[model samples]
Target: MANVAAILGDVVEGDRIFSPTSLHLPEFLPAEAVVYPTTEAELAAVMACAHQHRWRVVPTGSGSKLAWGGIGAGVDLIVSTARLNQVIDHAVGDMTLTAQAGAKLADLAPLLAQHNQFLAVDPAYPDRATLGGIVATADTGSLRQRYGGLRDMLIGISFVRYDGQVAKAGGRVVKNVAGYDLMKLLTGSYGTLGVIAQLTFRLYPRQEASKTVVATGTADAVAALAGELRRSPLTPVSFDLLSPALANALGYGEQFAVLARFQSIAAGVDEQVQALSALVGASLTHQILGDDEDENIWAAAGKALFPQPEAAGQTVLAKVGLPSDRAIAWLAQLPSGSLARIHASSGLGTVRWAATTAEDVEKLRFTVADLSRAGVEGTSGYLTLLEAPLSLKQSVDVWGYGGNALSVMKALKAQFDPGNSLSPGRFVGGL
Candidate 1:
């Protein structure tokens, strides 16, 4: 502790250094102390000190997702980017923006909206999730159907290496193809590689109007509509498949549902809505939501996968990916009380439920294994236990990644963090 204080000098005096007891962090993160670095240089210095002492450090922003991923063996210190919140620049003409990693997505919304532009991502907990945290977790929501993943919107990034050196990749421009693609590599690295410092993203213009069409019916009927919409010429910003539990929560009946959102000029949005309505016809019950109703529905959808603050301790949240055509079948296999929202086109989505005991969660894992075995040929399903109790996490692998690239991932981890000092074992395959 004295050594770290000496290394930081007056920069970390007074309340800047926090005892582990003061914060409500996860049990896996047994941090001795947490430090807030106000600048990139300060962050680098902290990392350097940790490197010299061989201290295991965990990097975080607002600690919104600190409980996610596999539990690391040990943690000596926590490096937080909360104090580094700053928007460096907004290149409106080029439709690009650069901001410190600690900047909250919610705060950036109105700022970007001033110019009729947005970051084109719908990550979880916008008010508390930071730019760096979102990129690190890769929590982009259904918006990926139209705007793509965070890796596509991220044009540039700067991060502090394990050895405390500042490094950068990509650039401020959207067309830069120079050097290695670290942006993609670090986007979902879960802080195992380094601590994200700053980020640059390509922005998109806000549409003039928006409408959401929700159609509810049997799984087969909804799947058929999803297939038809995918083959049609209409463009939807979000195309999602809602499980019976989730649909019921959103005021739809206890049936599988397909929800699509279209955003464009008023006439274009109306035209597409009419086209989709025609396709839906009398075969399935459907509704067109606009204005406040449309916005409220989507907001509620994002919140559905997360437990309320009071229920956070008893809830479990997991992400699942499978063949697009098999999503309905997979949803049908989930536990009775579970709520799920899977992307109809990409087959990636979250499943959440409340469990009073670890045994309940273990049963869910068994169900996942059965579904993986039943998947289509050449395509296996996988699930990641994103948020859960420490007991459940310790019993099961958080990231159920059974892929062939693990050896390569281990090699990269060894190269980037030879000491395994940065968020050790929190990433895939415990890299």
Candidate 2:
């Protein structure tokens, strides 16, 4: 195996080579490697070299979400898919599209909608995020409320293992569940599990009509409404709770936005709308928002996660999951003095929080770590975004805690790429 400089050639510009980490200014990157491959053949060549030498490999999509997982323990050669972007297939009638990992969502969304259908699982940063990155990171935003997250929408995936073997799982048939759901197994596993090269997902008809009903209030009140809205027959794509202040940022003065998304034949909307009204509190009244309105309010509230005062200056952002009811109250336990922003699924279960600085992240680490040791804290599971300072990497326990499934995760990683060459310490349990 050649030295990193020799093997990567021009792709390895000494010292000048940069990573997606700086975009968010993350704290740590354990390995020191970068490799850009223009084709699958080049990817294979690079993988062959890394595998032979037992070098940790980090495969990248758009790098739009490098902050999603723990910092790469150390990158031996950043096998970037930036150059491998291509739409291999767009089977409209089949409602299936296939593309290289580096293909951007901005590129895919409009294309999918051309056939009156769309890839429903999209985050706010659709323009910069790639299909593979989003899946590897398992990211989805407000729209996820309606269509479900990537794990549910993903139908098939093809990737390169650490040992350079190309493998695939799942199939294009939207309804088929022929075997173990390897595609889902990889979802939310971070990049440690596999390097997603191409993916196929079931799409939904582009929403014909949608609306957001802003319901403003306190956290407890919002929690109650969140439950009510979720249980109602309104069929909301999602109902997100915004802080009174967050609501104001979106011009909703102290009111939490209960964005109830709807999709159906035109006539039923009136019935759903009426049903929602009956379910909400008497104190709450909605300001009906249309496409532009729905777009502006939630866009600011949903994707505005990064700017959250708590998470803004920090180098990490984490998405956490717990029983739906207790999410709001958990915010009280965030690192002291940390500026953070949070979004809870209508059920109060899944939440995403972005912490501002590396120091604040340390606060988060200990907080979650303590809870883990004690066992049965409010935060059941979490995904780290060590996208901050390198120093914080050592001080803080980045991946807060784990469940009984971690042993299984490590075993699977070993089984898939026994070399331990793919995203070594970047995933949960340092797989």
Candidate 2 lDDT tens digits, 232-269 = 65577765655444555666675544566666665666
Q: Which one wins on lDDT?
A: 1
Residues 254-296, candidate 1, lDDT per residue (tens digit)? 8999999999999999999999998994668999999999999
* Candidate 2 regions with alpha-carbon error over 4 angstroms: 9-27, 30-33, 178-180, 307-311, 331-386
TM-score of each: 0.95, 0.84
Question: lDDT of each structure?
Answer: 0.86, 0.63
The CA lDDT at 187 in model 1 is 87
Backbone Cα, N, C clashes tallied per candidate: 0, 31
